[model samples]
Target: MKAAVLFEAKQPLSIEEVTIAKPAAHEVLIRTVAVGVCRSDLHFVDGAYPHAMPTIPGHEAAGVVEAVGEEVRCVKVGDHVVTCLSAYCGQCEYCVTGRMSLCIDAAVRRPKGAPPRLMLGDVPVAQMLNLSAYAELMLVHEHACVAIDRDMPLDRAALLGCAVTTGAGAVFNTTDVTPGETVCVVGCGGIGLAAVNAAKIAGAGRIIALDPVPEKRAMAEKLGATHSFDSAAETVADEVVALTRGGVHHAIEAVGRPQSAATAVKVLRRGGTATILGMMPLGEKVGLSAMDLLAGKRLQGGLMGSNRFPVDIPRLVDFYLRGLLDLDTIIADRLPLDRINEAFDELRRGETTRSVVTFG
Candidate 1:
């Protein structure tokens, strides 16, 4: 199998021939169909988070199941599936509590010193978030993937794995915006735009989409934003407060930055909540006023939009099929594995919503 491996930070991802392993008892083998190039992948390439060297970087993906382990019952061979990073161990405290997104059981992956599920010749390269859809094939825990309708295109289904799940989940699950709620999303990338679309679907009275890039603001309006801001203008928070009678019902910080996180907290209404969906660097903290927090406002975080992927994905696919969800508009480009470097470069520029690697 051929895969694009990260050789260094901000460098080209080298395409190489690699061997992928078969599934274990609780895993499945998927032949890559299409994988969305996500911003989260860039976080690893740029060293935002520490990952093993020569890693395969891709998670937002949908592919066909080539094989399944003995323990797999949810899907069968030749089934079209989308992968989710939030693998849950059903017996964990979090899973039993219906907070499976926070499941921390050791059932998914083995600890260090144990044999890995994937290998490159003699070297054991890490799989980013466990999906590794950049390669021609992937082996992942059965719980980490969900089967979608065959009618939905694999390329579009791939985006639902991450961007759509994160963006829509943040709105429908985490924040629970009422019909008349006012929302402000801090970034207009894939997840941020998803938030805008979700806000529209949620019937937000006023949706303010904020991004430094003026062009994304335009895209946001097309998606569902009632108003869009460049965010480079004077004070973004002040502008939101002025637009809304008081403060926004919810403020979402999709950009993983300390300043944007703090800004989300500051702009919420007296009892509103701010949902942080970005994967911020380890040990970084966002500061907030104690007085404001005491006023009943709250700060929260969402992992995979607090998703139950198996159930949520099918419904989203239905939403897309019925013309409620718009995957056709968000896709910007589709390239091959060899062009992975170009895809990463385009991501750094914030040039488009999503780019997918379509396997031949």
Candidate 2:
């Protein structure tokens, strides 16, 4: 199997012939179909977030189950599935309490002595986020995936694996964006645009989108933003407050930057919550005034949109199939896996919404 292997930080991923091991008792082997090039992966590529070297970095993906382990019952051969980074150990306290996304039990992974899931010749390659979908195949815990309808396009389904799930889940799960409430989504990348679309579906009275890119702002409007602002032209928080006549009921920081996270807090109404969906660098702090806390403004982080994939993913797929979810607009283009490096370059330049890498 060929995979894009990252040898070190701040370097291009080398396309190499990697070896994938067979499924273990609770694992599944998938024939990679389509994988989205996400900003989260770029974080590791640019060394913004620390990660082990010689790993495969693509995560947002959908594929067909080629085989399943003896104990895997969630999916079978020929099933179409979307992979998630948050692989839960069903017995963990978090998983039992319905917060499966927070489950960090190492039990979901193979024991130390077990054979590596992926290998580069004699060396083991660390799998990124449990599902290294950049390769021709992926071997992941059954808990990390959920089967979707076969009718759904793999390219579009790939987005649901991350961007859509995270952005939309932040609206529908992390925060309560009730009908007639105002929402302001900071950053208009793939995740930000998905939040705009989700806010509309949640019946937000006013959906304000903030981004420096004109093209993204326009895309946000097309996806359902009631108002759009360029973060570079003026103060985004002040503009959002002015437009809403106060502030929004919910604000989402979709870009993983300290500035964007601060702006997400600045645009929140009294008693409103700001959900930080971006993966910020470790040890970076997001500061808030005591006065803001006194007014009941809340700031918190959201992992994978606080998802319960087994339930949420299928419903999301249905939404897409019914024409409610705008997946077609989210996918800017599709390229083969060998062109993975170029896709990341496009993401860094903010030139495309999402570039998916396909196996075929």
Candidate 3:
């Protein structure tokens, strides 16, 4: 199997002939179909986030189950599925309490001393976030993926894995915006666009989309934003407050920058919550001002959009099929796996909404 292998930080991933092991107990092997090139993966590639070397980094993906371990029952050999990074151990407190996204149990991976799931010759290749979909195939815990309706196109279904799940899930699960509420989404990339679309579905009275890029702002309006703004403008915060006549009911930070997070907090109305969906720099801190805290403004992180993948993903698929969610508009380009680096380059340029790497 050929995979893009990242041997070190701040370096390009090289295509290599990697070997994939068969499924272990509770694991499933999937034939990669389509995977989204996300900024999160770029974070690791650029060393914004640290990870073990010689790892395969792609995560947002959908594929067909080619095989399953003896104990795997959630999916069969022929099922179509979407892979999620938030693999959970059902017995963990987080999982039992309905917070499956927070589960960090090691049971999902092979025990120490066990043979590696992937290898390049004699060296082990670390898997990124449980599902390394950049490769031709992926071996992951059954809990990391959920079978979806076959009718859902695998390419679009790939978006549901991360960008869609994180963005839409933040609206539906994290903030729970009520009808007539105002929402301001920072950044108009894949995640931000999905939030805009979900805000519309949630019946937000006013949906504000912010991005430095004019094209992205226009895309946001096409999806659902009632207003669009240049995020790089000096008075963007003041503009948002002025347009809303005070501040928005919910503000989402999807750019993963300190400045963007601050803008999200700045645009929130009293008692409003700011959900940070982007993965910021590891040591960076985000906080509300003392005055804002007194005003009941709150800030929180929405990891993987507080997802419960088994339930949320299938419903998301239905939403797309019903034309309620616009995955089609979010996708900007589709490239073969070998051209994965070009997709990342576009992301660095902040010129595309979402780029997908498709396998044969």
Candidate 4:
């Protein structure tokens, strides 16, 4: 199989002939159909986040099951599925507590001394996250994937794995956004735009979308934002507060920047909550004032939207099929595996909502 392999930080990923091992117990092998070029992958490739070298960088993906281990019962051969990075061990404390996204059990991966799942000649290639979906095929734990309806298009289904799940899940699960709530979303990228769409579905009384890019702000309005502001004006937070009388009930930060995260806190009403969904730098810190906390303003971080993939994804599929979720507008371009570098270039420029890699 051919895969895009990252050898060094801030370097281009090279296309190489890689070898994929068969499924281990509780693992599944999938034929990659569509993989979204997400901003999270850029975090590792551009050295914003540290990762093991010689790894395959991709996680947001949708594919068809080609094979499964003897103990795998969640999906069968030929079943369509979406892959997630939040793989869990069913017996973990977090899993039993209904917080499966926080499960960090080491047993989810093969035991030490076991053969690698991916190899380039004789050297082992570390898999990015749990599902290295940048390749022609992926071998991952069954818990990392959820089977979805076959009618969902693979390219659109790929978005549900990460951007959609993280964005919408933050609204539906992480924050208590009531039907009449006011929402202000920072950054109009894939994740931010999804939050705007979900706010509309949640019946937000007013949805304000903020971004420096005019194109993205326009896109946010088309998706569902009642108001859009260009952060370049240098008054996004004030504009949001002004539009909603005092401040919004919920403010979501999706850019992963310290400033954007701070703005999420600035645009919240009393007793409102700010959910930070973007993956910020490892050592960076976001600051908030003591007065804000005293007023009952809450700032929180969400991992993979604190998702329970097994239940959330199928219902998300239903939302898409019913024309509630806007996957069609989310896709900006579709490229082949060999052109992965160009896809990342576009991502860095924030030129597109999402670029998808379609396999043959």
Candidate 5:
């Protein structure tokens, strides 16, 4: 299999041939079709996030199941599926209680001391997430994927594997935005645009999109944002509050940062809830005033849109098929696997929304 391996922080991923292990009883093997580039991957690339080196760095992907382990029944060989890094152990307290995203036992990847999923000769390469979709193949636990309609294009379905689900999920499941409400999403990247579209579908009376990039802001408007702005300047929250009369019913922080997290909090109405969808650094603290809690403002984090993939992925696919979800527009371009380095280059230059690497 061919994979783009991360060898150093702030360095380009090098393409290399690697060996992919087969599936275990609880796993499935997939022939990778399309993998979407993500900001989280960029964080690890730029040293903003920490991880083991020589990693196969990709999670958002869609492909066809080539084989399944003995115990796997959700999908079969020849079934098209979208891969998720979320592997939930059904027996966990969180999983049993409906908060599957918080299932501590699930998504507990391979044991720490074991050989990683990808390897170059004898050199082990860790997977960025449980699903190392950057490669031509993936051997992942069955719980880390959801079977989708075969007709959905692999490129678009790949977004559902991560950004789409994370963004739309935060709005639909986490914050539970109600109709006639107002929303402000800070960051007009892929996730932020998904939030804006989700907000529109949720019947939000006002949707404000904020970002430092003009192209992103424009894209957000096309995705259903009623207004857009350059958030590079401060006072964005104040502007949002002023425009919404009092404040928005909900705010989403899609950029992983303390400033954006705080801004997501500051722009809400008295009882409004803020959902931080951004993947914040592992140990970095999000400063919040103790007084804010007393004021009835709430802050919460979400993982993978708090998704139950079997249910959500299908609904998202239907939405896309029915012309509700905008995957084609969101996909700025597609590149062959060998051009994986170019995909990352476009991401760094902010030249595209998502650059999917296709198996060629």
Candidate 6:
């Protein structure tokens, strides 16, 4: 199987003939169909987040199950599925308490001294976030993926794995934006756009989309934003407060930058919560002013949108099929796996919503 292998930080991923092992107990092997090129992967590529070398980085993906190992009753060999990075161990406290995304048990992974799931010749290739979907085939724990309807297109379903799950789940699960509430989503990339669309679906009274890119702001409006603004504006936060006559009920930080997170906090009304969905630089601190604390303003991180993938993903697919969720507009381009670097280049340019790498 061919995969884009990252040999070093701040370097391009080279296409190599990698070997994928068969599923271990509780694991499933999938034939990659489509995977989204996300900024999170770019962070690792640029060395913002350090990882073991010679790893496969792609995660947001959907595919067909080619095989399943023992105890993998959640899916069958011919099922269609979407992969998630938040693989959980069913017995963990987090999973039992209904917070499956926070499960960090090693039970889902192979024990030490066990043969690796992937190899390049004689060397082991580390899997990125459990599901290394950049390769032609992915071997992951059955808990990392959930079977979805066959009618859903793989390209669009891929987004549901990460971008959509994170964005939409932030609204539905994290912030729980009630009808008639105001929401301001920072960044109009794939995640931000999904938040805007989900805010609309949640019946947010005033959906505000913020981004420096004009085209993305326009796209947000088409999806559901009642208003849009250039995040680059010096007084953008003030402008949002003024427009809402105070501040929004919920503010989502999707840009994964300190400045964007600050803006999200700044645009929140009293008692409002700011959900940080983007993965900011490690060790970077985000906090509230003394005044904000007094005002009951809260800031929280929504890891993987606080998702329970087994239940959330299937419903999301239904939302798309019902025409309530717009995955088509969020997709900007589709390229073959070999051209994956070009997709990253576009992401670095800060243009385009999402670029998907397709396997043919």
C-alpha RMSD values across all candidates: 1.6, 1.0, 0.7, 0.8, 1.9, 0.6
The better candidate by lDDT, 2 or 6, is 6
Winner on lDDT (2 vs 3): 3
Count steric clashes of candidate 3.
0
**lDDT by residue for model 3 (46-70), tens:** 9998899899999999999999998
lDDT of all predictions, in order shown? 0.86, 0.91, 0.95, 0.92, 0.85, 0.95
lDDT of 5 at 307: 90
Candidate 5 lDDT over 5-61, as tens digits, reads 889998888889999877767778999999988988888888988888888889999
Instruction: State in Å the error of residue 33, model 3.
Output: 0.2
Q: What is candidate 4's lDDT per residue for 152-186, written digit by digit as tens?
A: 99999999999999999999989957998999999
lDDT of 2 at 39: 94
Quote model 1's TM-score: 0.96
Assess candidate 3 and give its lDDT. 0.95
Candidate 2: list runs displaced more than 4 Å: none
**Tens-digit lDDT string for candidate 2 (1-360):** 899999999999899999999888999999999999999999999998888879999999999999999989899999999999988998989999999999999988989999999999999999889998899999999999999999999989999999998999999999968999999998888888888998988899999998898888999999999999987665778988988888999999998889889898888888889999988888889966997899899998889999999999999999889888898997898999889899999999976889899887
Model 4 misplaced stretches (Cα beyond 4 Å): none
Clashing pairs in 2: none
Going through the candidates in the order shown, the clash numbers are 0, 0, 0, 0, 2, 0
TM-score per candidate, chains pooled: 0.96, 0.98, 0.99, 0.99, 0.94, 0.99
Clash pairs, candidate 6, are: none
